[model samples]
Target chain A: MGFDWAVIHDNLPFLMRGLWNSVQLAAITVVLSFPLGCIVALGRISRRRWLRYPATMLVHALRSNPLILIVFWFFFLVPILTGRPVGDFASVLAAFVVFFSAYFAEIVRSGIQSVRRGQLEAALSTGLTYAQAMRFIVLPQALRSMTPSLATECVIVFQGTTIAYVVGMREFLHTTFLVTERTMRPVELYLFAALVYFVVCLAGSIFARRLEGKAGIPR
Target chain B: MSDPLVSIRNLGLRYGTFRALEDVSADFSRGTCIVICGPSGSGKSSLLRCINRLEEFQDGDVVFDGASLRACRDLPRLRSEIGMVFQHFELYPHLSVLDNVTLAPRIAKGKPRQEAEETARRLLDRVGIGDQAGKFPGELSGGQQQRAAIARALALEPKLMLFDEPTSALDPEMIAEVLRVMRDLARNGMTMLVVTHEMAFAREVADEIVFMDKGRIVERAETARFFSAPTAPRAREFLDRILHRL
Candidate 1:
């Protein structure tokens, strides 16, 4: 019935905690998954069937299944199997890690493959081993070419963290849901949450644009 | 007088079901410049790539110096001894000219950074692109990039150098600069196998001319005799077709 400034003032600390958890989850997921994504990318492109098959299967399976199911599986099944208590945040994080890593692996795989065959041949003929060539020559050039796409993927991934709410992680959306249910102000609280998400995504987009500009990647 | 620096016996290569090279045999002495001229898809590039095992072969073997490449367990070790320059230059786009030349030396040979830098600088200077060592490949002109690529190959101090149409991708005006570098390399007694279309450079710089067609050596002889009085009718015809353009 009314825009309640009082409720907004009252729930500031709770919302801030939720926001911090969201940020922490995103930060940890990105740091852990980026290197893992590169390894998955390499494994997907590996010449050996032993390495490529399982990597490809993992990516495909994760991509096709629902992210919510992944969260449920990690939260409900992981503890039963490991017989150790998994933290709530860790469960949500594991799910996000699996989902985003598959996406990033595709990005890196396509990026690495976009480098021409002649480039590898030239480097090999110049006496560099495959590892040396990939490290210094191929990946650097490929990562350059893939910058714009990679930036866009990063933004998508940052926003995708909203799915962490399904696993009972108190992210931005979950905080909004909790505040609305508690105070009976669904419309106002949800609007504020949407605004927060928009602000984050916008800031991330701006930062990515700056990175592309500095890296000299044309839009 | 001594054993061939690069020797191939009955070399055959197949891609899937298609045969790219068949029963091609040759021996290249050290410090000699050999030109391989052929029509498109006649195995000119394949032949050069085979030397460094860039393109794997199906039959027979490639012997580099005294070692059999086919039998050797480590291909990277053998490749280090054979330097190759490509038609497209294929310089790494993200690296400066200096880094492009020094990467293999530092990584593959485990050379110290100072030594690698020194060797890279000397090679850059030798190839006439010392001033552009800090420039990325996309920032340089086509001719300058190709020269940098050559310097990259030379930084390894290879026993043999291979050129696959080094000048073919350059602009007409730029071709002479790359050819000049090639001629200089030949004059320095760096054993080379060049697959090129520039007949003038071939006639002037090549110690021997090898004419290939249908995946086999049609004819090979001293540059003068091959260009002036060819042995095979195919060589004469190929020469007649390209030479009259000048």
Candidate 2:
């Protein structure tokens, strides 16, 4: 099949708009999931059973199910159960938040646990409360170690944004699909979409490595 | 005398049926230093940690400044009055030596920034690392890191200080620098509980010496008497072993 530069040129603006939407979705999901994941991670590692058990169950449950199924649950099942229609964008965002937070929580838990036990003991012995110790001492160090992993997760989340197309969210892939339908140029359009994903993810991985180097934490 | 700054009454601890400490009790009078020395796994470190509630004990209680640790509602407040330095130094790798020293005072004690910084500087100077304040823990030598850890512990102006083999992680030449700083602290009348294998430090600085074995304190006496004429056979054997090693 011959590539059509003119067709892509004609649809460039529309495709760019879809890319913006995808970026926004990924950004919001990532930003919101970070604090939520930290809380969940703290709960997962808490000494209290009330916090630990629920957090453990939630992480496992969300992680076990496929991301597409979670998107479907929010898009279709929520409205049916609540008897109120949820916006397509909101439902998709909610699903992303819920689904990605489970993974993020595990990252955060590992990050926090990676901090030496001596760090916690030092903070505590200095008369800092547990929360204060976490905020000032543990979290800063933990989060630094977590940067590379978290960057990788962001790339994964950005790729996962393509899945939102199934729920009719007009993200990059969805926009590309619409263009291909009208123009009948499936191969070229899909190739272009793949190129965009490759570039963005490659940039993300390089940024992650630079960040790990800057942190200078001994392996 | 003055109700002792800290009193440990029959402290007991266990780890899944392996007793780490049993009936370990002692009183730390104000401005006095006590040295606890024993072979590995003798519960000396565990006994020191229990004073600050770093390790939880199942039986008995520690009374600090007349407040029972078990009944004290504000543990952080109680802890703020005490300082602890670790064998590994435990300096926050992410923070500068200055920030590490100032963190507890600023965040935990709610000291004003100016005041905390001043106190931190004074402490860093006192520990003989005034020039190293801007350096991260990774940038400092082992002895320098230990001194910074001491400064960090002292920033809160604690009534008591606990040292858990603070010089054990240092090189032979580096150990003397840390010991000198600790010796000054002892001379200045800081109430200290030290767990170490440093027999010379125990002899010169400790007001009293405690010897432990198999999770129990086997001997307690004035530092001179304990070194010159230990009452317990275990303590005598330990002293002989350590002295010969040195």
Candidate 3:
């Protein structure tokens, strides 16, 4: 079984479409979840029980469950409840949005916590309101600390886009599967898919590390 | 005599089950400098924080500028009028020294950028860190950072200043630089309530020296009298211990 370059070369266009779908899923999820995560993180640490309890439970609940299960739930349940058939892309995106937001919430919560307590006190004593303090002082510092962790989470979300395959979305993995079935070259196609994921995620990790080095707190 | 700028009456504070302050009373008259000295956990910092309502008290009241802090509707406004410097110079590390000094004025007072920068520059110069204005806090030495923190506090043009062991975190060599800036502020007649262990600064710059032990004011007297003849045995012991270390 010689390695077949012909199949990949012929199907490059078809496979690129799947790759584009994966990229879109990851990019949209990252954009949407980052802010959603920040809000949830704030709720988790809020002084009021009313805000804190539900946020804490939502994060914990989502984190404990598998990502694929959420994808299944959104795929099966959203249409039944809404009485309208949502597209496969929307179903998978919703699942990723809900699932990754919990992880991001934890990351952001820890980042916010990492800022010195004295920073908040200093800001407050300067006559800045609580909102002003968080916005100008705390969040800037917190976001800096969050970068490395956030970058790692982004890579995870990108990789997790593979699970979109189960929901019948023609993302990278599903496209690879279809190609392998058609060409009877499962091993070659799957290996190429893994290579693509590795390259993207590894680049993301390196970029995150460089950013972390630049923004890390001095001792 | 002018009315006291800050009047603390029977102030008591508790953290969980532990009492951090109990029945602590004092008066800080306008344009006067009062130095508070005490062992760790003797409620000096808590008392200072209580003046600005940074810490809630279970008993008594703090009246600042003839208005009760407990009853004051606008805490942010009250805090703007009273500047506090912490032991650790909590300069916003993400900001330039200039921005750190200008933030409160621009945000809290709604001062225009040009106006706030002018005041911030003047304050940075006043603290002797004018040249370091463009630098981030992490790039400056501890003394410079503390000085910048002072400038930041002063940019609000606060009526009263609180120093919570401002020199405690500085290097031994850096301590004098911070004390010098504080001495200058005292000489300029900025109403100050300082919690510190610098006996020399207390004797030189303080109008009154207050000594606390076990959450209560142990001795309060004119600086010369307190240093020369401490009435309380605890005050005498503390002075002896601190002086011996020096």
The per-prediction tally of clashing pairs is 0, 0, 0
lDDT of 3 by residue, B211-244 (tens): 9999999999999999899999999999999999
Model 1 lDDT tens row, B86-171: 88999887778898899888888899999999999988998898999998898888999899999999888899999999988889
Error of 1 at B137 (Å): 2.1
Q: Across residues A1-219, which tens digit of lDDT does each residue of candidate 2 receive? A: 567778887899999999999999999999999889999999999999999999999999999999999999899877887799988888899899989999999999999999999999999999999999999989998899899999989999999999999989999999999999999988888889899999999999999988888865531
Decreasing DockQ order of the candidates? 3, 2, 1
Scored against the native two-chain complex, candidate 3 gets a DockQ of 0.70
Single-chain TM-score of chain A, each candidate:
0.91, 0.96, 0.97
Question: Which one wins by lDDT: 2 or 3?
Answer: 3
| TM-score between candidate 1 chain A and the true chain A | 0.91
Candidate 3 lDDT, A55-157, residue by residue in tens: 9999999999999999999999989988999899988888899888899999999999999999999999999999999999999999999898898888999
Candidate 1 error regions (>4 Å):
A213-219
Give the per-residue lDDT of model 2 (tens digit) for B1-246.
668999999999999999999987878899999999888999999988889999989999999999999888998999999999999999999888899998999998889989999989988998899999898889899999999999999998899999999988899999999999999999999999999989999899999998999999999999989989998999999888889988
TM-score of each model, in listed order: 0.95, 0.97, 0.97
Off by over 4 Å in 2: A217-219
